[model samples]
Target chain A: MKRFSWDEMMNRYPAFFAIILLVVALTINFILQPNMFARDTLNSNMRVFLPIILLSVGQAIVILGGGIDISVGGIVSIVNTILATQVGLNGSPEKMWTFVFVSIGAGILAGAINGFFIAFLRLQPIITTYATSFLYVGFALFILPNPGGGIPAEIANVYRNTTPLGLPLAFYVIGVVLLVWMYIRSTRYGNYLYAVGGNAEAAYETAVPVTWVLFSTYVASGFMSALAGIAITMLSGSGNAEIGVPMTLTSITAVVIGGTALSGGVGGVAGPVVGAITLGIIQNIISFSRIDTWWETFVKASIIVVALAAPGIINLLRRKKV
Target chain B: MRKFSISPPVAAILLAIVLFLLSGFLPNGYGSDINVAIAQATNIVRLAVFLGVIAAGQTLVIISGFEGIDLSAGSVVTLTAILTYVTVKGEDDKVLLALLISLVVGALIGFVNGLGITFLKISPFVMTLGMSGVVTGLIIIINHGNVSGKVAPIMTRLIARPLSPDIPIPNAIIIWIIFGFLMWLLLERSTFGKHLFAIGVNRVTAKLSGVNVTATNLAVYTLAGALAGFGGFLVVGNTGVVFIALGQPFLFPSIAAVAVGGTLLSGGKGSYWGTMAGAIVLTLITSLLTTMQMPDSVRRMVLGATLLVMISIYGRQRGFRQ
Candidate 1:
């Protein structure tokens, strides 16, 4: 058996840096907040972060499958608008359930549209998704001309306050998602995903279902985006046509910070999940640091740029040393 | 027959004509009057000129290959515009200094991005995306999230002044024509242009042929940044003011225009004139939508749909080429 070395381990396990980042950010946030792990405070932070975490998971999958889904945010927006408009604040539980299913359908439909074009028609993923993003957002705007109307406060409270086994509900949800992903990873389909992403022509030559794998990846992203939409809708207790606009870039950043290669076929969901939390923690650090409000956006962005460049910087330094 | 074959620019012109006629049948009949149509056409060209200038940079970056894209163009434009506003402070004397500063700042950001991509081996998309965030944040911090100041009168006069009552062409169009001509000459008539295209089509081939990929990539990104800064100056002249997010809407449209203009996101094939036509087509579409008095939602949906359709047409044609 080979003896463990720090460098080897980091090289083999891509999530290593993300875990380290998580620990560091947690420590800083803990020091600043002091209350640190109060049940309610932890729950609130997790609730707010759940949506992006979900989005990053979806984004990570698409990147791994050798595609990017800029339209995921638009999918989320469509779901949010649908829920907000169809199942109004006073809508019955049955209505809410119905719309939730419809929301999932909307997400899937949007994803399929993107997949149809990118995978089958051979359009560039970025442009196709960018165009669709506008379509989804426009549809959302059409559905709700303004940002108002939401699930009832009671429904929002359920998402905001829910805990199981004394852990935040988001943790359990994340656990379930991860478990499912692991199972999928063991399957042939998962292997196909990586193969297609690594090299589509080679994958095809080797009998991998390139088109299906590419198409399914987008469909999966859509499904996850739908879930993220529901989470964000509940978290905010409202809807806006623009709610998802800012999340797209953040999700992509999280994936990069999590050590996912944009070149594709070389990442996992867990890293991005952790990366998402790290990002949320960074935001908290800014707020708790109590620096000028104006500096918050700047500082956060600087940290991200540094984070994104870190892997490349490390590789360069290693090359130099050699 | 081959010489007269329908090119992307020709197709764009055809679409514009059809759309122009369709706009006449609009329920509200916004472009029906010959004088109004003429006036609207002038405005469309003005807007197209702004988009075209920015997109010219995008074309260079996109054509440089390696899955190249420049998402930071809009943010760079916004940042430079804000800086210009503050530096010029409505004074004629400071305009020259402000322009110099803007160009330098833009180039510096692009250099950092290029370094990240070339030396650090960062993906073009992520590098630019991260740079965009950093620039936006820097602007926000510098301006305390609230921008203030006026554009120089001389600058405004140069871009916005009407040429004649009957003709209605803005000086901006004239400037765009000169700039476009120079870009065309550089990209189509120069040795560097041919090599850049070669690099886009196949990096390995280009490298084997003695192309200096690293230096050229660096220069391309730097050029894109400088163009964005120049575009920033033009924006101030055209709008007479700057806002925190003045350049936000530009990011998508620039890419869209480039794509619609027949530039392959996969790189190695496209033209400046085609992109200019694409810009004009997009502006005309926007004007039609605005004239219809459709809600923002409808406008967005239509825009997205239009782009999707255009992409599908081009994508199919591209597939046959492969």
Candidate 2:
């Protein structure tokens, strides 16, 4: 039997590091804010974090599949705009639900466009998505040029106040996402995803459906981005074409902090989920610490930089010691 | 023997000309009058200089491979611009000092980025992304999210004004031409350039060939940082005022320009001349769209579609076996 070690565990599960980091961040947040675990506070925090969490999951899947979707944020904007315009503030719940499905379909179609360029035409993922992001965001702007439309207040309240079984609604959504991920992980397509990401040429040589897997990853990313858009829109009860732009980089950061390698085929959804939460907690800690308001951005950024560089620094130290 | 080809730079120039002629047909566009068109073309070229300067750094980093990218370029530009503003204090005599300070700060940021990436083994994308956050935070802390500074008179004269009474060309264009030439030489004629391309093509192979990968990477990143800083300095000169997130808009365009210039985002092959042409082409597209009186949304969609089509036509990657 092989012996377990810290390094071995980390190698086997990259999320281990993220988990430890999350625990530390949570502890600091708790110390700073005693009411952090209170139902209301937890709900608000989760609601705020949910969008990035959702975005990160999709980003993680794409990264794991050896590609990236820079257009996810744009897709989010498109969905938000679609929902805001089609299902106006006075629209009925049935109309809202109808638009929701339409939004998801739009996201999938947008993703398919990215997939076609990247998978079928073999364009670079970064550039392809970067260009398409403009298309999606532009379309959103066309739909809602002034950023004023929104869903009904009642629907917004449902997202804002909902707590099922004394837990935040976000928790349930996360649970479902995890469950679905687990099932996917158990399937052949999941194996193919890893293989393709790890080494596309090798996977192709072994008869893995490389193009399909790559295409699906982008599609999945689009789907999740749409969900994120819906969650954010409901929380804010408004639509803004530019809202999702910043979230793109934030989601990528969360995935990296979650221990996922940008090079692909490493890490999982769980790590990024925790990472997204950790990011929110870190923000909470910064806010509750009573630091000067001007220092807030700097402090948060410094923490992120340290977090990004920490693993590599530790490895360097370890190598030196060895 | 090498096969005859138009090359990316020439192709980009040709495309820019085509776009320019096409825009003439649009109502209120410059192509109706030869003098008006010449003036408009000159204005577009002036606008493109900034992007060209910034994309020069991007070209270098991309050519250095290992997934080399500098997401912090925009932030660095903002940081340096603010720093220059603070240092110059609107004094023409202090411009040189401000320039030095900006370059140093920019190089320092790049050095830190390189340290994290090369020595610490952090991915360039994550390191730069984190650094971007840190830089933004630093900016907020420095100015309390309110930027207030006047550019020196000489800077305005050089960046925004023409060279002389008879000279229709802006001094910035002349400066850009000189800078572009130097960059072209550096990439094509320098030993460092050769090492950069080799590293981008294959790190291990370059290392085995006795290339100092770490040192070279560090230098490239530092240079890139300096260029971004210089760009910031120019931006301040052109705008004559400093503001928060001033460099934000330049980020995507810089990357896009690099890609359109025919540089492979995956690295190993590229040229500054190509990037320059790309900047010109992008500027022409934006100008054309603006002249057509289209809404922002339609403009964005068209831009996105254009980039997608352009990339698909010329930027597709060869298959693995090939």
- Candidate No. with top DockQ: 2
Model 1 chain B: worst 10 consecutive residues (lDDT sum): B313-322
Q: What's the C-alpha lDDT at position A288 in model 2?
A: 89
Output the lDDT of residue B100, model 2.
95
lDDT of 2 by residue, A116-151 (tens): 899999999999999999999998898899878899
lDDT digits (tens) for residues A58-85 of candidate 1:
9999999989999988888999999998
Model 2 ranges with Cα > 4 A deviation? A1-4, B1-5, B145-148
Q: What's the lDDT for residue B318 in model 1?
A: 38
- List iRMS (one decimal) for every candidate: 1.8, 1.0
Error of 2 at B305 (Å): 1.1
Model 1 misplaced regions, further than 4 Å:
A1-7, B1-5, B27-35, B145-148, B164-167, B317-322
**lDDT by residue for model 1 (B1-322), tens:** 3555567888887898888877777777644588877766677888888889889889998999887889999999998888899888889999999889888888888888889888888899989998898898888877784667888888887789876666668889989889988998889999889888998999999999999989888988998898899888888878888887889788889999999988888889989998898999998898888888988998999999999898787655333224
lDDT value, candidate 1, whole model: 0.88
Fnat (0 to 1) per candidate: 0.80, 0.91
